[model samples]
Target: MNLRFGLPQPLLSFTLLLVWLMLAGASAGNVVLGLVLAWLLPLFTQGFWPDNPAIHKPWKLVWYVLKVIVDIVVASITVARLVLSFRREPNSAFICYPLTLEHPLGITMLASTISLTPGTVSADISDDYKMLLIHALDVTDDEALMADIHKRYEKPLLELFS
Candidate 1:
């Protein structure tokens, strides 16, 4: 168990195991097959894992994912309501949100999270990656939207990846 792997091997193993379980569904036979696949796949691909930011907190990771799920549901409803309102709302506009999280992985996760939620899409990342341009279905309050993103996704992501 050399530290050269950067992260503990068990953590990587557990992640692969969970991914297998999700991909195979929840049946007992699938679970057993997933476990076997999880164990064997990593052994053949050891070099693909990168040694980067160490996630020191597991609870924060769980919280971040849970928050994203809730946000996605809320955004879906908002988008549905706007769509059903019959031309009451204007087409969305692009908004520039200043970002403080500099990590590449963190920025990527943020972008993907924004895109996954309905009513919003990640349009561009600035050349310096210091700003994110997001298009919202209804651009009522730019400041409020930025604040919401910061409080909801960015803050937790900063904790998790930065």
Candidate 2:
């Protein structure tokens, strides 16, 4: 038995524990079961993952998560307002956003973040991974939307996964 088998992937284990606890309701039994599963699942399945991306700056991830949460909240309110106002149709548009970050995980995080926020959904990504398609409920300025995504989401992910 390898010594590292006890904790092959710390982040995955933590996420699995939290998810298990959330779904199973955090009783003592559930906690113990969650811990067991968290430890064992990663150890057993570690071979399937070809590459595990390293976090260059783990602290930045916290800030990035907080920022996304705030954006979700603000977007929820904006979307609610738009929905309530029946007279004006939302300036809906599909945007082709060119991606800059080279890492697949970083691109995935960026797409997930965009989808999590209200009024915007990541529709698709190009085959070459050069562009992402986004559908927005309201998009008055294409350049501004692209720039905002690049600045708020992509930049941090690039730094985090670098």
Model 2 scores a TM of: 0.79
Q: List the residue pairs that clash in candidate 1.
A: none
Best by lDDT: 2
Candidate 2's residue-wise lDDT over 28-114, tens digit each? Answer: 999999999999998899887657788999999999999999999999999999999998999999999999888888999999999
Model 2 residue runs over 4 Å out of place are 1-3, 10-40
**lDDT for model 1:** 0.82
Each model's C-alpha lDDT?
0.82, 0.93
What tens-digit string does per-residue lDDT give for candidate 1 at 76-117? Answer: 888888888896966678999999888888899899999999
Clashes of 2: 0
